[model samples]
Target: MKKTFVKIGLLLAVFGLLVGCDNSSSEVVPPSSTSEEVVSSSEEEVKLTEQEYQIAVNYIVRSVPLVLERGVKVPTNVERAEAENPLPTPELKYGDNLLLITAGELKYEDEINGVYLYPEYTVTYSFLEQEPYAGFTFEYDDIGRYFAVPEYPRYEAEYDNGGNPIHTVPPAKAARLYVTIHIEERFTTFNMDMILEPQAIIHDYNLADVRSVPTGSVVRVYGYFNGYFSDWNNGVLCDGDVALGLFKLQEFNHMELGKMYAVVGQFTVYNGLPQLQWIKTVSEVEPADHPTVKEPKAVVVSADDFADQLDIGNELSGPLMHKVGTTVVLNFPLRYKAMLDRDGNAVEPGALELGKHADVVLTGKDSDNFEFEVKLSLNYHMGTDNQAAFRDFFVTNADADIYFTGPLGAYNAINLAPFAFEGTLSLTPPVVS
Candidate 1:
């Protein structure tokens, strides 16, 4: 009985807020599962009024369309990222950066808080112009569609009249708010430059992003970069929501950090701040089989982190290994990649791409620690549509070098991100460990 009333109250509150703006200290809508909706979250717990709930539902419906567009679709199905495919090469600008993240393995984490939150994220960056020595931290736009709590009532009170409280509930009964993100600041520096040298020191903070920040790099990334944020230390970037100032880089081939990117052009201090004019681009991708480097470094995620299923929000990491034999294999086949379709013949990955995305695949031997096949398929993802419906994108039938027969469980799982770029090369001697 009590539970039912609380739910009803929540609905009413949410609806009310939806009808009229809450005018609370809200910056942005959370990361909508669908693209068009404005999903925001509040740290406090509150029972949404019906008005707020109605607002939420409508927002959700609208948000869903943003992630899925009739305009552009990936092999998976990302609405906002629908414009991912570009026919003619576009001029790279603040806006054109989106093209880089158009398809396949097009996402990465910027290390917020203590973990790698959001599989799809913009690279963390800072300029010699910024004040803080540390680069920057990032957070999701509250993809859960959570709203800021309007301040929880001291007690969940219910009254038939306008006089006294007839019944009450605890804070636990109120809606629970969540802040989903982790941050990690690298001890790197960015030098001022007009030419964006992919290998510049400042680029070091987000070497992962800049390295894969070009079109056709085959790397996919989610989220956006900070423009001019106010609170640099608190871990948030870009103050207001109006500028819509975010550089979403999705498509770049993976590679080693410093070696993959270089600094270009000239940087100057404008009124005590660093300013950049023309960050140049490099043409070549880090060779898949680069000499002198290792192949297939492993990044393990405990089964617990993914909740038995991989999710877009949350930080994840572990040991990295170069040899396939050292990788941790999972008991179940990961649906992250694709194989011969139900039809049998090799299904063109682009055909399977229902959304804006590319595929990440590997060709090698199963390691001793995590024995498996060296199958080729997609791994990472980057798009505006980050949510539950994405499960359909994974495949389980690719031909791997080795096959598993028993229930190895999550312990068998391994992450191949560290080795996506630069393969072990015959020409380059392996550096002595």
Candidate 2:
């Protein structure tokens, strides 16, 4: 069947930051229900009237695509910062410390400096411990010439008017935050190269409404839920903007750029230039919060995973069974097997293993879920007969109750050749109606 499924999103910021997002809620599904007079796809002959064939075929065509569109989501958060007295102001310009972060630990490469945080929290400023203890190390130097602190002499010249000891310098301040967030909507498209950069912010109020907020000043944005102030060129983001003219923030050095970011510096109109600085903890930034998983539901659908490419969303809802070594003697008509292998073949010992990309799915009455999977195989009788006799030998639930009632000859056309299918099928994880 021709089905479609996927969700993705993207946005760019100043300094060439790029953000892409994706989330899916799908997994392996199984089958559970059965029909009253439905023709099971067993290798037996089923006498179907014209009306019954149409009803079953219509159901299979509409359900599979929905599975792919619903995808799964997982959570991840990471942070890091340097520790120094009156410490260091993280900057991108030369001679400053380069900060690198992951799930844990902060490495001040330039200073051969390494400091561990509160295990779950991180610090970014150059501050002094409020209550210094014996187990903790705290010391100062008299001839301090490095760092962003004041340079003082070891001793004062002895004079009647100025023989005094110099006062000690204070420590700097820094902090880090941890949080969790939800991955909202996901959309995917190929030609989005122009959606780069949310920089070059220009705010303006209409001449008719001067009471409205101005265009280029910092402000908080709020919706029915809530909102926050956003900064350009300061995220592990790539968004094309005016202020971050040629800085390639989209450049990924270690891992993917999607994993790195910075929020520091000032927002100013440098000459005729207008832009926000690369944010470096304007405040202790908190991470997004974790989300909760929903309660489970029933599943009336399932699939046989013979091939790795088997997608569970596109199957019909009902009981599914598989038998390989012999001709199937249940549900379907005996003629169906003969038609499947015109030469009257038996099972090939243990040759009925699932393949790489074949699968079978049975849905509920409304394709709301899956049930179980029967793993078996059958012989393919394509080139055996002088005429193409076994060409119609596949699986389907379409030929049920084919006589004079409503949908008397309707049948599902969703079929897969065992020679082409693969699986010791299972149908429990996906939809549960």
Candidate 3:
């Protein structure tokens, strides 16, 4: 096949490098802000000055680790087996670091086609912690350095059984980068060459993989509700035959009790729990009822861990701040103090008056028997019947152990409460008299 080489440019910034493309027929591409030297080559020989070779080696050694850590896709053919020990290398040395180069090869085709190069032993000293394997590609010209990777396929081609194209000519693979480099003397070059292949499809994540994704990144998650707290517009999605305790917060009406839904949003880690916030899209796909409601893992922690005090306007205070958006079982028991009317006045536990706040005054310390008070806010649309049921439940279960679930979050002032039940506030069943 006929071949050509196109020289591109690279702009190196403090955080990362941005690649540039040049389509002009000129072989001597002007350098941008990044290039310190230039490289030239012909059909038979590829040449780089000693100074240029050293710069390239140093840059690659320092930058490749960052690239891989940024979630750049690893080349398909790179072996991932960590070197139990450092591998052997070639002898020729270059640059102030006396960096050794093992092997280097450059291939060029037509003017419109990009050049390809491979290096065998570039950065042997440092390794990226993110992945088991790492590699980098660069091309230089009179203008600047250029980094390139395999281009992704734009469209999947369809073919007939005979293996010939049924509709149109096959499209060529996309070109990723082009560059030129200036070399002063014969210097050792690294021989690690990464073959550019078509990009692969990425898999969407399940609840099990929530923590593996970087925080604050938009992710797609699908699951069915194990159970939900209608008091708050949040629910738990069950996967892996269990309620992973992955919290999903949505303000749109109510989610069907056992329906499966897919949500695309920013995944946040709040109060040691995985929560989906800033939900962009949520839609019911179908019903998923097989996985029954899974009970929460009841780990005993200090009541202080739940919340020191409920503040209505600012971020949460005390350990509960970190426990936001998570389900926790409090070790210290709180007596149901009183149900406050909407005006924040304390009313009898059985008062029919509807209020926005529920107060829990501490009764005793675990071993020490000390006491403290914590407040809870209830903010949700409970119909007349549901409201009466909630009042009865609180009044009836007043003596039961309280179980709290949902993401700790801020509420608008119109609602008028700093601390509110994120999900459901459970009270243990009172013993029969």
Strongest candidate by TM-score? 3
What do the candidate models score in CA lDDT, each in turn? Answer: 0.23, 0.19, 0.39
Ordered list by lDDT, greatest first = 3, 1, 2
CA lDDT, candidate 2, residue 365: 22
Q: Candidate 1, residues 1-433: lDDT per residue as tens digits?
A: 0011101000100100011122242422244311121122333334444443433333332222211111232221112124466232111111101111110111122356332211111111122213222111222222322122222223322333222335543321112111111111111111111111111112221222222232212121111222211111100011111001111112222222223222232222222222222223322324342332232232233324323222221112222111112223332233223333323355554455433323233323222334222233122232223211222323223333222211011112322321122231122222322
lDDT of 2 by residue, 1-433 (tens): 1111111111110010112221232211111210011112233333323333222222211111211001211111100011232222221111121121111211212234342111111111121123221011112223321122211112211111121213342332221111111111121111101111112222322111211333223221100100011111112121111002111123212222222122332233222222233221222212231012111111122222212112222222223211111111122111122121223243221232222121222222212333322212122221223111212222232332111000000012222222212121222222223
Using alpha carbons, what is the TM-score of model 3? 0.35
What would the TM-scores of all predictions be?
Answer: 0.18, 0.15, 0.35
Q: For model 1, what is the alpha-carbon lDDT of residue 89?
A: 17
Lowest summed lDDT window (length 10), candidate 1:
1-10
The regions of model 1 sitting more than 4 angstroms off are 1-259, 263-296, 300-302, 305-309, 312-433
RMSD of each: 29.3, 35.4, 19.9
Residue 314 CA displacement from its true place in model 1, Å? 6.4
- For all candidates, the clash counts are 123, 107, 43
Write model 3 residue lDDT over 1-433, tens digit each, in one string.
Answer: 1112233322221111123112233323333312223233344544443443454444443333222312332321112222354332211111001111212322322246443333222111111112222322233323333333223232332333332334333233312112322222222222232222332222357665665777655566776644444454555565533333334454644566456777666666554456666565666764333233232332334654433343333234344332332344454455666666656677776664543334323242344454554444544343444456556766787777665433333332101122233334555422222
Q: What is the descending TM-score order? A: 3, 1, 2
lDDT accuracy of residue 424 in candidate 3 = 49
